[model samples]
Target: MVRRRLFSVNDHFYQGKPRYFIAECSNYSCFCVHVEGVQNTSCRSYLLFFVSKQRRLFKFIQPRTQLVATQCGVVKRIFFSTGELSGDLQGSILIRALTREALSRNVVVKVRRYISRVVVKSQKTFQLYGLGGSLMKQEGLELLQDTSKISSIGLIEAVPHLWASWSMIQNAIERVIEDPPDIAILIDYVGPNLQLASKLRKIFPGLPIVYYIAPQEWVWGYANQKVPFLLRYVESIGEICDKVYSIFPAEHAYYQRHQIASEYVGHPLFSSDWKKGNETNQKRARESLQLALDAVVIALVPASREQEIRYILPIMAQAAKHIQDQLVDEDVVFIVPCSRDDFRAKIQQQLTRSGVSQFRIYDKTSSSIVIAAANLCIMKSGTVNLEAVAMQVPQLVLYRLSNWSAWLGRNVLGLQIPFIASPNCVEMRLVVPELVQENATAENVSKAALNLLRTKHEQQRMLTDYERIAKVLHCPEGTSRAAKSMFELMQTD
Candidate 1:
């Protein structure tokens, strides 16, 4: 009987030349010998092996030996599930953090489509792929699908895209099964992610799954009537995920109460240098927009989602008209920060149709600049609220769901929450005025915006609240900490 052994050549370059390795196998032992500066005639290399048995040496040559690096190190495929523009941004940041942390741990990260082969000192390679947007792709995520454009908020709003979403989920599951990931990271966009997690848990029982920026069931779970649903949600997450990284202190506590393996990693917004801006930066931003430094700029952020743009932009436009009518003497300019380039035409039409003349539309790239330059913001109740807070811009949060969806949520689902805006939720108080559902009328929103703009005391009070909230959410290198935790989880036996 004869024994056979195979060895992989490490794909590396030595002094600007490719290196190869040959394996020598005997009847009882096998070892690899490195050959430097070997020029391969073709992709395949032949290795001659000698076996010693009973003090006799036998010579053999292996044919068609492929110069591949499979046995060089461990290859960890990580799948990331994220949705919406905010999730895309967060996912990008987290991806960067993960890459950095991996490098620190002597692991190399390679994007399948962009990177063919990477030669590094690390023996481990992390291949990242999954559902995200262009921003995540830019951060080197081999995207399975793009969910940014299709994300919807309310139940009624999501109904139209249900079939497409289901199809996407099915396709994702099929792909994931075909090329299984060693770890899965689920960001926000709770609906499909929860479903995906449940399916993955059933399919791959031992797979390490993580939930980052988990659902806000804790906030809605405050209602006694909603506790059952919240419990189910918590249990589903707890059962599916190996770890849950919470961005908020309250979120961490809530998960812990439910006995979910969780850690508070703080908000990812604070991980970057764009957390807050000073007056000088504000002035510079205004100047960049060709606006006078003293001009009172009111930013209208209707959100990035298509349903949100449809339901909220018109009302925000109408509110801008009302605000313009009230601030006739002051140099107040209304600017709509388009979160997506495709949404610009819709926003323009809505603003124009609303008869607002002194308004400008900025592309997604200029959103932060517009926020920094703004005196106040009239926006939807979402992650942008926290962004406005970071910029120290007093804002009036407005959200309008479909009438049917709102009714169902209030009457059937019994959804109750103290605050809709993240800043308010973080502070556990009314940091910014929230006009939600029926209350988010043009007149009400404009009135609130005018009050914030005219009343210095109110603006100062909100600014103070924002400072406190920022302090609470500010954890240095928060995303990095989360990546470190996730990497450690990936290393568990």
Candidate 2:
């Protein structure tokens, strides 16, 4: 005989008004309670309850998860677009770990993306690794869940297009209304995040939203345009958000300028295992690169993104030639550490097209290894430059934005900072070489690179300065400090 079963909530339901709650005994899907005493149109004690399925139980949208996973949690979701994931997977990884930690404390964490699948975590631990984006569609998640004791980890894929992202994000909010989390941490990916925050405020009006690794509005020269929306969603968070964290003191100024409240929590990069490289690794890497024992190896790292590659690769090839000619028997080898194989192909194509071949491209070697091996580095000014500084590699920085965009930046916005490199920005001085826009030429970069290779005293001084900068930027409390601040606000709300 088929037996009838009642949905067990271990709590009483109010029959006079609509209510929201998770059906824990019934696949844990969100549900609404309709008042039996009142008509559907009656407003005496009626409420709206939107049932939404959470992602603590599915698989990644893509076949392979390309995002970095530093922390573990009950729900695993992708935050940014594949295009934005570009070089570093740190933010994704870090957040995953942080979420997992929160979940261990019995906090219900929900991950929102631009996908349609429901992801739920049934295990207490999980490891997320990127295998060149070739994810096993079915097997890995279950294996991880069983072995690691992970309670739930949903690998939900969103539908394509920005609207789909909005829909998925909205669904996450609806789920939160049924089961509120301690805090909502939106990690980077500014455009979609901003929209999600706005939608969330409408539903979970009191929920605190913390922005991690904020957009470079100052660099984009449009902090003014974006600040208001940021304030609107973050305003409630501001009053009770234990601490609105910022990566730098300058960022606090931006928040203050816009009248948006924030606290200077310091940079995350420095808090990682950013230790100096061993002398032995440096010696071994130099030997593998085929440099003379006494000769200084000047590593040349251009930007990893496709657009940046187009403008920077040619300049690097030319710079290599220039340096070779200027410093007679200087033994300066151009080592390019590429993020993807296509980056290597692009650089090779540029050199082949120009009939030049005098450098080697590095892949197996980590950036830290490259930094340790180099006497000096000529790098594209982005996150990599910061890595170089932490590794004590004195650098000559070069960067070029899209032509049309550069024109608008120069003409309309009038950028305050003369240089684009973060190391220079942190120092508020040209502590390293920066050749931007028209100045990022082969001759200019090569000349600067060669100068450092020959000048030992200057390189040493630069290293000393880098050490100082590292000390200033390093976050003392690490992820816990930021996590605590965000958690306090989320719980209080």
Candidate 3:
């Protein structure tokens, strides 16, 4: 037989046809190729098979397993949890924003959950934790923590001290390091999150931790009680995290001055266009109040929380009463968006006590309905101020802090801008009037409302300025932008 070479093109054949034979090697079921042109092809094949098996069989053969030190990504994790603010609405919205970001990158995000019993409006109730699950499940991401257990602040705190917890965190670190995330963001809460970051650092020193809207370090001068502990924990965070996003620009500047690397992503609220209640919806709300479409409707948002309702709502109710009598055929209504039915009841009780039942307090309608129906708004300053500006509803911003914060604002920070609304801040002028601290009273609020409602040109100018601010803030489809940024950060060395 000619026995033509099984493989083509060989340089070292001494014979006419380079014939090869296959032999089954002894005691084990091993196969060998005999190359006529090459010496001891069986030995070479054996060595080759040995290496292939090693590569296939060994778990630590991957380059990532060889060096844990070079991995540069988020390490250790902590979360801030405060008992007061029910982050449900904010967390729900944020998870939705993050979902779109994760989907485009082809990455599966896993989140855990827990639940806690909290006092809402002085009534005990259980609120869900793990806002990410519902949104994550919709996008087909893997989830870890029990939504019921992860939400409980007390349970998370019991870890390490009361329960065997390091294993869980270590496993999470392993997964993260395997495919390091572009960024690890810790939002809002200062207590638990700071500790979590510190723990992760011990496991993976190279990981970066970004603190979003960090605790009030500037407010306490970086040396006060919890401030020092936070400062130390954040030092490791600064070492690991490439960026820290702050809620207030001034807060960012403060971190910079203190030598922490930080940036201002601007408030996430600014990125949203607070929906102006639909035209039909606004019309329906206006009709319900029995006001002419031409007759200006003003929105009054007092503090919605029970304590706020007790102290601030009556004042606003009084202001509404004042405006109700003066503007004939004009509509003024108190629109209080409540988280629960009980909150609505609490607000109604206050309305009765104040003798302002003539003014309707809306608990069920959309906030945009209130904002769009009204030409002007009177609201307590916080997130609402930003919303008013977004909707182009000219507003009067108001706030009253405890004496200490007020004193710090006056003697220490000396922030140039007094009015908290974004339109006013961007314009560097009082487009909206702010009655803060001692000034947040019914009489002052009413007087300010009169000035704004009566002056047509002033209202128009404020609206124009607000429109400009809105243009400045309308971030281009933040999900894609944020996703791109996140992906790019992950790919970095």
Candidate 4:
């Protein structure tokens, strides 16, 4: 009877060999599952549908608290993986947009065709959960592992300790393998995520894995890790820039050549809503932080990640001290805006040790306001750089990766591209000075800031370049476009 029923269901829903997924039913020891019996093809679909219903019934009884379920019959479980401050922010934005779109449509991903419109009420719902930071928590993603905890560039370089974190990595993979989501959205924080994506593809071979804010190593050179990762793992590419395709056609074309879905989702920063918030809050932002209008304020914006703070905050402080020493009589307000609350004490320690204890560490206000209120910015490379650009503040960018990692990125990888900063990359020239590795010392940073402040002509030139950057980056519907593309991926997915 089961065999006969399976054949009837297969004939109704699809034509080819039926693919099956085992869904465990909780109440009893006899979990309903796919019997891969070549002798019993008839009842396959019917049994699977029955099992899914039983699982839903089990979930309802148990009251699964974490995952969000959609209205359609087949539940669309979406998982996102991200590590680092910027990745957390981008991941949060992407999920919010996806949820908004998903909720608006109120649609499920898969429903058995054998069921009529009257019976369609039996379909499973849409749900999303995954790994990320504080923002993701607010958006309702089940925290798989706090990716924010790994938010250190220098810590990533710590040899044995980094390897010791492999158990956490294994846990992340096991969670996915145990009950995989329909879609896996991998944000930036390339190294670990690429490793995870590669392993994930092995478990769920055909699962649609989409990448947003895809690594920009291609912007530097063809020999970067991006080529192999994209070729081996990613099924789709969602870019943040319009010029990326043109800038790296060979690398960009690799996605198309492999039949992977590709899209030019505009930068998330260019949206009107973000700009309005940045624009409207300038005065209040200053007042709330008690920033005097006439005071000369220079923002020391460093890395949001732990490794970044470990390496960058000290150097940024050294530069700030240099700038302050040069302007002894002038009342200079040095504002260091931290991204995470956990790092606030460490930041205060660094400032105190550097003899810059008087500097205000504003963790309460947005980095946008800090950058907006500043005459100049001395920062490490990250979202903060773009935030500075978004606010039209002239900035000096700096970066220092771990020695061995830096050597590999240069020697083994052959990464010789110029312009580390995003705005500079977009402009195809140095709109702002970039000091990397050894060149990112306090004296060099202080010198650049001094020149920008002292020379009005150079400042104007940089500001004009910023205007062009703003124009290039402006996409009023960036978030909407990204959301739309994700849906398109879902439809064919």
Best by TM-score: 1
Question: What is the TM-score (0 to 1) of candidate 1?
Answer: 0.81
* Candidate 3: regions farther than 4 A off: 1-91, 107-184, 189-208, 213-241, 246-296, 304-307, 328-331, 339-341, 363-365, 402-419, 487-493
lDDT of 1 by residue, 1-493 (tens): 0111122122222223232222222342222233444456333343433335453535433443333333323455689998998998789879888887776764322111122332323333567899999878987899989998878876688898888788888999988876667678999988889988899888777678899989887775443335535325787887788889998888888899889888887887766623432223688889888988888789999978888887898899999999888878888888878888888888888889998988899887677788888988888888888878777888889888889988877777666767888987887777789998889999999888888887999999988988888888888888888888776655521
**Which of 2 and 3 is ahead in lDDT?**
2
lDDT of 4: 0.62
Q: What do the candidate models score in CA lDDT, each in turn?
A: 0.74, 0.52, 0.47, 0.62
Clash count list over all predictions: 0, 45, 18, 16
TM-score of each: 0.81, 0.64, 0.58, 0.76
Off by over 4 Å in 2: 1-87, 96-183, 217-243, 256-259, 273-281, 284-295, 354-356, 489-493
lDDT by residue for model 3 over 1-493, one digit each (tens)? 0112211111113334322211111221111222333354322211111112223421112111111111111121112222123232233344455544433332211111123211111011111121123333333333333121232222222342323234434554555444333235555444445555666555444444556556545544422323433133445556545566555555666678768876555555555521312334456756765556765567767663434555567677777767776765754455555434456776677666766645455643356566656778888655567667766677887765555545654555543333454455554567788886678877888898989988989889887887777665555454234434433443422
Model 1 — which ten-residue stretch has the worst lDDT? 1-10
Clashes of 4: 16
- Could you arrange the candidates by lDDT from highest to lowest? 1, 4, 2, 3
Sliding window of 10 residues with minimal summed lDDT for model 3: 118-127
In the range 344-366, model 4's lDDT, one tens digit per residue, is 89888888888874588877346
